[model samples]
Target: MTPPPAPAAAPDPAPGWLVPGALVLRLMLVAALAVALSGSVAAWLVTRASGQEAMRRMVSQQTDEVEVVARLLASKIEQSQKVLRTVAAGITPGMLESPSSLEWLLQQGLPAVQFFDTMQVARDNGELRLSLRAGQLEKAADLDPTERDALRRTLVDGKPLVSELITGRTGEARVMFTMPLHREDGTVMGVVAGALRLQSQSLLPPSMTLPARDDSQLIVFTRDGTILSHSDPTRVLGQVRDEVGLAPVYTRWQSQAQPVVGRGMTHVQSDHIVSMAGMPLPQWIVARVSQSQALLAPLRGAQREAWWLAVASMALCMLLAVALMGWMAQPLAQLTFKARQLLKTSTRQRPETEMHWPQAGGEVGDLVRVFQGLVQQGSLQQSRKDTVVGQFQAVLDSATVGIVITRHGMLEVVSHQACVMLGYTAQELQGRPSRTVYASDADYAQVGDRVRAEVAAHGAFDGDICFLRKDGTPVWARVQGRGVRPEEVHGGTVWILEDITAAREAQVQKSWGRMHDALTQLYNRAAFDERLGQLMTERSARQRAPALEEEGGEAQGDGVVLFLDLDHFTVVNDIAGHDAGDDVLRHVARLLVSHVRQIGWAARLGGDEFAVVLPGCALARGQAVAEQLRAAVRAWEPSYQGRSFTLGVSIGLVVLDASLQDVPSVLYAADMACYDAKRAGRNRVETRHARDVSVTSSGRMALGPV
Candidate 1:
């Protein structure tokens, strides 16, 4: 039988499916390694970024502390300079010549200053004139080298000088502030000086009461490295660089053009963050130092924890990779083949073919369903996109105001109303630069910047601006707009513009009419009433204010009111026609305006009646003004239709005082005075004293005590 032809040379057993087992294991292992490496790098980057942020915050805090200390010290030095100036101004040559008188003067004045513990006055010749310490008079003597040098510098510059740290003759750490005293001829006669005691708590501001952390320090030092003040009293007046063992910091500070901040070694060989600021007035440096290691201890611990977490995640990923490698072998191979086939089919725009996946369950079935859903959803989304776009276009076209959408200030879409308002078709406006719709290049640039800034700050902007039509005519528009995404500088915006030129003109005319008379163009009764009410309210508020009370609340002594009535105004109107009467009245109004234009406001109350409010004119001066008005009326010769005659006016004067409660009371008093002047002579002046008054239910003034 030939043993079945020796098994017919059985074909080599089909290569055991190598893609299933070997390919899956290799892919999972590579993915696991990539995840582990990425986690490690990400953790390190995050830790480093957090540490940098913490360092930046610590440095900023130290900078604020140094700036605060410097400002407080400069302000204290300025206060001392002011005190020295006041003392210098009062000290005459006679007082400086007599030691006893000088000592007495200082004893009285020195008690007022809380910062300075000692004060001394010295002659230009370097002889101490007087010394006041703790409110006691002390013996005067020759000036020391520090005091003599400060005095000589002050004399040379004719300005104050703050000295460096000085050990007084009594062995106390002090800084001297000196100002020169000048004679009547501007010659230097003497020097006035004040001392800031380094050890005194009052020398520092009350707000300087900190928690007193031991590791932190504040140091005030001169440019040469001598310390003026320190948190540790023992270090006060010592050389800061030597005391703190920070020679590098000192050397860096000496050459620094601006403020400095850094981490450096301190006197104890410990790392510290140092912040330094220079004072402009006193020419000193202020520094704040804090232990860097102590500040960053928490961050270091967090870094360690982060590394451990990364390691734990890597182990978890390795376990997951091992488990996933087992099940994913067969399914991954089948899915890879199917995915490539599906992608190739999708590119051909073929009708989606139903995938004949194996009747397996779990991840394989879900993967098949996901692919089918993607194909079906893409078709549905395409159908809905057309409908939504159509609806958006409909809404945009129907907008009432001129609506526009712009990307980077270039027009993208415009509404029908926008086309009509700008005298341009949508084809002409869309895709064009927005500057085309502005009145000028400057208006486009300025208005675009302003509107963008407003939208950025407040999310919306509403303003009236000038826009140009296609015909190059300017249109006033009320523009309302909002940013689509303000935080992104390149994000576009939407604008709604309403034409408001006619409305704006009408508003202006209405506003002008409210404050002026239609005939004379002078202020009307309503304007007069509003202005007088505001003045009275201000005066009453001032009278009630505590500050005004402390200042004695003196009355405006020169305030006055002048009221006048034309004596023969009605007779002229009866003799001449009303047109001639109008001419006469206009001429009289012009005369009154010219007279009070400089010193006061003039108003026409009614027919032939006028009033003047003099803000700073006495009642006696008001009488002079009244006489001038009467003389002007008497000198005027009007020829109306072959009739020539002169007219007279009766005048009344009332002084404005705190006793008057309201404008009505003052007006009533002036009217009664004018009636008296008319009854007395019909052309003379009369005066009325302000009195307590009552108002009847008819709104008529009834003069009497309340």
Candidate 2:
């Protein structure tokens, strides 16, 4: 009555289909597991690799920053050394005799040093001199014997020595550098010493900032394990500790001459240590990066969330695989047909392919939405091209450069900037040939040839050219031009011009100033040489002229060279500033110009020196003219700063004939005569004929006139 053992289930159709179906389901499950495992493994491996790479990059960047800081420190050290050398050079034996010179050296030299606490000059005779911001102070006596001996050692070596950290009179911790002062013959004269404070900020990198963590620190120590400077000045300065944990690291750095980087596990205070050596100075700079609760707090939370998300993702992938397998088991032929149909539709139009993903509230639906958004974006791009082009045009027009367009050597279109720079209206410039603005036909042709050559060689031209303005004045412009087809140009060749007249003028003036003295604004040495050559050639030609013989003269054109030097010019320059001296020079130039206007060339040679060249003037006539110039300068009085000052000029005259071919020799003779006039007395004129001078041991001259 138990229901006859529930009718032993009938052995239905062949089990082959069911076996393959079950096998397919198991295979699908294994494949999904494999994919998820592979993905997770790949993600973890990539993350680890990325983290290691990031760590290496961070370390490399830190090392580079450290190197930069070290280089800056080395520069400061070099600067200090130069300053010490300069101070030593300024203290000479002559300087010691003059107290004012000593004071001037202290006032000028001390302020010039960039990073110094004090400057002291100590003589070998136990005399100590100190310069500070307040004023100069002389010590009561020489320093103690020990200090004097130490200084003498530094002086004998002629090298700078870094001293141990010691407190100054101002109660500031500082280190001193002593450099020796040597004579021209390499004899030790004195010692020049400079002090630098050893505060936390003194030696530290200007860009360095203390880490936010309270336990983090930046420590700087000498090579011999002595603390020099630290982020916490109060804690490290003048306090020497064993620094046991850091000694080995320091030794490794010294041997390798490189940075040491590692994590300090047991120290609780510092979890990471980075140390490097400073160049030129025997010092080790170390930065300690510590582990802080505040920094690690948020990381723990992020790690927890990352683990949960990874696990959830793996489970979700497995469930999706199982569902997909189950659905595929029902109808393989239908799925294949559907996939082929979708592919064919997608080939013809992309819009239809967007609907291929399942859109019925699942992961596949979200992916389908993303793909659809991408297709929509692609459809919208073409509509924005015109706007972008308009913006580009706006940027071009707003640029400050002047733009001009030319076609076949004729102006086509000119921008507003071009009209403003060239002093031409836009309408006036249009359709005009380039020659209308270029001033000269020769210049226009030269420009055209250069343009063609530039385009042939380099495809463009960039340089400065002078252009004529509408008013017939020249304007300098930095111009760049390129050749283009008529169609590409919208008519012509395009050019950009930048007005650089002011800068060009400034450069020219600077070059002029270098060759000529500022006060006299005269020919200077270089200009005099050029003018003298021209005069010599003219005199040579004139000597062969037939008119000289016809006139029954000496048959030789006479040339006179006179050298004029201002006496008491220094007194004027010292009493009045250089501005007043310039005024006097201008007045003297005008006087010389007026006197030599008839038959000669006059030039202010340089400073208070002047020169004159007269053709067809006899020796007597030249002496008379020289005397007149001397009288003018002697009688002149100039008022400066509400005071009147009288000055005189000394003149040296030399007459040259056709036979004398030595120009420099004549000039030297004239200069020597002027020197003699200066030595004889002020306000006198001396004349030396070229034929009458002879070489003698005494160099005694036979004077002809007063």
Candidate 3:
């Protein structure tokens, strides 16, 4: 009846077996999780290490490249200096002493070196007596006195000296290097100087290639903190100090003999480290490398792989979940395949998918609902990207100023305003070489050469260039160009051209107005002084050219300068209003212009003072012109507001000879002649022949005053 005691209560159903099985499943899950986590962590560590190594390699390579460039630049500069010294040493002491011989020497020496823009020889007395053949003898007065003194000191000290960047006659930055000229007896004779344009061809190589990175910048500076060359020389030249946040790095590099690398404290968001190398000329070549997100190409690929792996693991988990439900696996597999197909299709074409659930499904329906939400989000993101691109295009098209885009030297896009400014339809400019439509042949060639050179030297170029319009007239444009590979560009370089002709013209006119007199529209005293220096140079040069015999048996190589002053002009202004005085001035200026137009240049020196520059004119012709000017002024009648007035001119003429060396002496002689004319009597003409010689004025001759 016990019935085996109910099988002894089934031995408590072996609770130990159930517990051990559960524990075994839990341990497998934990082991798998630990293996996955460890794999992920190890992969992350490897990726981090690889990234660091790659960066280090890149930095080292960039540093080496920078050093090579610095050495090349230093070698070029040194070679140029040596060539100039050789030329200077060849000149004899007699050649250095004589203006004509020195000019001859320069004419022969300058063209030998391609980099020299102007070669000059001057005495210790600050007289620029000679210039090279390619030189324009204009505005010798532009030379700074301090610079001249420095050159003179170098010559006296028997040494070479390089000057800081200075502006030349053409308003371009140039570096002047001077060498001393010595006699056989070791006496200082003169100084030979060569002016090199920083933009000259030999300073840079024909081409340069940048690494596959965008956020890196390169800068070159002289030992004295002078930016000798740069990718954008115009922007960086003469802009001293670390104002652009590169100063601390530059200072540290210049102060230290070894290379220094550190993060820029001023710009923290940018993980920028500066590496600098030095050249023989005391220049510190610097390269700044920033840890840009775009440079993380390997990391980006790893992240994409990680994401896909996660997606695959999630899909497998979902499949396992469905299998546990005891439903027909085929239908669920079909549903999953359909969802995957829809996702793939949406990714390939457009992010819009219509997903439906099978009728025999509970889990299938839930899976479809989740996938549908993902599709909706993908569609929303696509729409946002499309909208942003469209808005950007619209803004660019509707901009106010003319915008032109060029790729690989060919025009790609032209805004409406750009089309109008260039006098071309957009279609006409499309696919055509930018030079074909806008730049002249010579200018285009120059620009093309410059572009190539810049790409080789600095990897980019940005500045103003004069572009010819469709009408064949030149228009100033701010042209900015950067080198790009196929990935950066649609496949070519990105060049931007902006019409800045109006602004440039305005600036030119403003500068002209500042340098000219308002009343007479003539050069003011400052301009006059400048011209006087140039005229003196011409006078000296003319005295050296082959002499020509005139029909009257006279040599006519000498130049005469006449400085004239109006007699009793203040009295006329007191009697008649300034308006009438202006009329009188106008009449006098007309007379002077008409009388001296053929043989001389006339400028209104100031109120009641005028200067007449008679080139290649002898003392007799100068005196005759002065007499005619006096007669014309005396006979002239100025009418203003129904009133008439008359004025007379007193002329003081100074004839410069081969002996005259300084401008001040000629000016003093003319001023002395003017004083003599005034003291003798008003309305008379006087001439001073030489520095100490005085002239007798014609007696007070009167034509009735109005």
Candidate 4:
């Protein structure tokens, strides 16, 4: 039958894979997944950190490069100022008085002005005293206002000064550095100035920028977003906001209030790494911009390699996890196999070598030992179970009597002896009706009813009952039974049966033997006396007898007792040493029985004495039978062991009538008559009636316990 489905509220079963596979496989899978997940996360963190670090280093390097370029520009301005001061030191008040002498001195000093575009001595009125241009001394009619401003600023502060970008006399962008020409008393005589042109590469260092072939650019721009220097000469002097790479950087600097005192990396534009450093005096910015991909190329390569290494490590760790899980699960597998094998085997005691268990020392090993102990305990229990079953069977086999157990009138168990008794096999008896062994249905019902009633009352029943054997013969049995649960209406009953048919027959034969004499096979004295008492009781009860069927059809008379004494029996005993006496007595008993065998029965009262009972004989007929018994006894010639002897019998007869109250009264009259005959003369017949009181005087011969 199919089972009902589980309720919806019940928890679902585990996945299909969990039931059959080895534990190690599952553990290994989990471990591998953990390793892979952890490795992926760790690799991501490391790669991201590597990228950030590379960007940091790239930004720092870019800042340093820009700063160095800015420093180069400042150094060039300082060199120009040094030249102006040198020229001012060479001037004196006397040399400045004459243009010819000043020209001569200027021509001599011009040799050292190779780093400058022009060197000139200016007057207090801002007129050029003398000038050196292209290695020649010349005089200019109009000086550039930037140079005049430097001269005036230098004379006023008594210190050298450098001017910002200005149009020089040559109509080119230039910066002029001027120094005060002082007198001996510290009065300013005039100013000496040097101008450096900015239209060419003279102001830039040879290696002032990164390689132009790359996408990286270096620009020196003012904090107000004007490009002072750039890798593209045409882009120089252009607005920084208009440059694609510099647009966001300029905007960022503007947002920070254009402070010219910091350097850092910032993401002003996507895909770009820009570093900026402040320049002196001009508030100019030396900014470097590079595509992030290019700037971080080495770091990316390292990250790729690191990621590959992480993947390889994850694989190696998973492999180790699988190996370790397999190693750990080995003991559990053995224990499982051992537990399963126990079911497939029949015998309790398996060979020691049949199973090999792990001896590891953790919980799994302890579990293995526990399983072993259970298996050993099971084996012991199995052994004990087999022994108990065997002992029970042996007890049944040797019981030697029928043992039948019935449950609800059905044979549930039949022992070997029970089978033998019923001539059926145990298998044939089992499950069969209990009535099959009974002589009849009534007998079966009787046994059942008795068992139910008696067992409930006293727990047991015993009686002799007839059971049918296989051949349908009745077998009398002494059946003893008990109920297992008599309070239940149809409870089981156990019966033990012993065959008593032979015993009953033997008892009957013993009863017959007790009533007869062994020697003559006649009724013994006690039996004869009992028969006389019955007849006497019948007479005293005044009961009449029906007419006897006879040859003459004569009316039947009252019963008569004939008592005989064997005469000369002592003479034979004295002559034949009692052997002859016994022969004589047997001979006489045979004679008496033979004479009365047709009408009555004979009994030996004791030694040398005999009696006959004629149930319907008259007194005359009894005397006549007595006389015939005396003649037969007198005719007897006895012999013993070949010696010859003769014996005679004296007879007395008495009528049994209502006058005789009991058996002893009848026996007494008969014995007295027999004594009278023996006293009158041996071998004579004497008759006495029940009313013949004169014939009584004899010693009391009482009957026994009868």
Q: Give per-residue CA lDDT, model 2, range 93-166, as digits (tens).
A: 76655657777777765455445655666675536654443344545342334344546668667667766555
Error of 2 at 646 (Å): 99
Q: For model 3, what is the error of residue 306's alpha carbon versus the real structure, in angstroms, after optimal superposition?
A: 5.5
**Weakest ten-residue segment in model 4 by summed lDDT:** 11-20
Cα distance off (Å), candidate 2, residue 117: 2.6
Candidate 2 lDDT score at position 320:
86
State how far residue 407 of model 3 sits from its true place (Å): 89
Model 3, runs deviating above 4 Å: 1-22, 123-128, 137-140, 168-170, 184-188, 204-214, 223-228, 232-234, 238-248, 251-270, 282-291, 297-299, 306-706
Candidate 3's residue-wise lDDT over 580-678, tens digit each?
A: 788777777778788876677777767788888887787887888889888888887766566676677777888878655655666667777887888
Segments in model 2 whose C-alpha atoms lie over 4 Å from true places? 1-36, 97-104, 107-110, 113-115, 124-150, 167-171, 200-216, 238-248, 251-270, 282-305, 324-706
Q: Cα lDDT of all candidates, in order?
A: 0.74, 0.64, 0.65, 0.73
After TM-score superposition, what is the CA distance of residue 119 in candidate 4 from its true location, in Å?
2.4
Model 1 Cα shift for residue 27 (angstroms): 2.1
The count of backbone overlaps in candidate 2 is 3
Mind giving the per-residue lDDT tens digits that candidate 1 earns over 1-706?
2332222222233333425545456677888888888888999899989988998888887787677777776777777787767777778899888987777667654444334676778787867777766666666553457866886787677777888777867787777888888899988888888777765664553235355567777777777888776767566667866755345687765776544332222222258777777787667777777788888899999899989988998889878877767655765656555554444444223345455546645444545555665767776897799899788878978888888888976999888888898899989989999998987777787897888688767778899988889898877889888767767656888889898978877887888888877777877777777777777777677767858656755444446787878888777788887887778778878888888776678777777787788775777777788788888887898888798967888988888777677777778878888988999988888888776334344665633211
Worst 10 residues of 1 by lDDT: 260-269
Cα RMSD for predicted model 4: 57.3
